[model samples]
Target: MVTTLLTPVGDAPWSTEEFESRLRAVPEERYHDRHAFNIRMHSGALSQAELRCWIANRFHYQRHLPVKDALITAKLPTPALRRMWLRRIQDHDGLEEGEGGIERWLRLGEAAGLDRETLLRGDTVLPGVRLAVDGYVNFCRLRPPLEAVAASLTELSAPDLIRTRVAAFERHYPWIDPDGLAYFRSRVPQSRRDGAEALRLVLSWAYTRKDQERAVAALRFACDVLWSLLDAVAHEHCPEGS
Candidate 1:
């Protein structure tokens, strides 16, 4: 188990410490880092084609990150919060063209033998992958800002995941250009910084037991989105009955 909640839900409101404990438990238990495809990926078991499929399909999700962040950014009540969240959008979209996380991700695609135009064209994206990514975007667009931020808490596990990816790619997938790993390498510190701020916001905003539970549920939904997207990719390529 990831964590044993110090306090049970449906009781009185949890103390801030206890509520935070619950949120921290989420990624430990539910983050897609534990997905089977990821397990195989880290073990250097994926064929080049399998790995490239992932790079191409995952771009479908990456390209929309700014769009999702922008939706959440607009709902922030304070200029201070909005300003802080705007950095997230800028991190992906960049201050000017031909920069930022999105471009770096395209370079990763190129290293994986996928052309940038093909990644942008979205033709390689599986139907389930499309649905999962779109669902996440819509989740931010419609849910309360608190829940949306809660969903982003998957970043809590992202730093370590990114690190593992960089190491694994360098060790296992020598066919890919090492420079193409810039996306994962840069994300290590970026995810930690982003996840910490997002966690603080969740802890502060979810002041009541109900709100805290909603945040937990939202994080669970986030885990589901990522896991489902991987399922789509794995189903298409992994050995039958895997």
Candidate 2:
């Protein structure tokens, strides 16, 4: 059902503008930022337990960010591309111990009342959440480099989401420490930079109809992955329907 919603390949190669439109269309239609779980989060409807559950499960996805980036970097064909992609890995992993997005996410977990050790160990990651994240990682590992880059175009929507989330957390979830909000705050600029680079790469590399179709499909698949992650979180914490 999700695959069926992707922009279909056409006989004629799309113009660059058309391809950009098709790529942007995925987030409008299917980005997980539209999911009910996130709507509740933004509206301050989630209970503290519900919020903690989300943070704990989402940490699993956060931990895999660099792994997926590494896979994409390994597949890049040029030193320039590899050099550009390596920044994504570093953004998540940091240059030294106890830094980067993953560490900041742990602080978020702790602020939300989740045990830091338990969060780091990832023992409570929901089954569906694990599968969705692993699927994205495997996609990066096995797909063509262009498709993998295209998948990361999900970052296009992330900066706006991070901004909204930061404001929501401050306005609604005041119990969380200000310092623990660093993860979302830090991502706003980083995602803008990363998304621009990924979009440029997709536009330049996927020049033909077939390649453009694959790029669109890859982005659609990524949307599905994120949506599935939220679906899992919702099922676990809001089973009666939020």
lDDT of 1: 0.90
Cα deviation at 137, candidate 2, in Å, is: 0.6
Return the clash pairs for model 1, or none: none
For residues 79-190, could you state the per-residue lDDT of candidate 1 as single tens digits? 9999999999999988999889999999998887787786788877899999999999999999999999999999999988888888888999998889999988888889
Model 1 TM-score, 2 decimals: 0.93
**Candidate 2 whole-model C-alpha lDDT, 0 to 1:** 0.90
State the weakest 10-residue window (summed lDDT) of model 1. Answer: 233-242
TM-scores for all candidates: the values are 0.93, 0.93
Question: Pairs clashing in candidate 2?
Answer: none
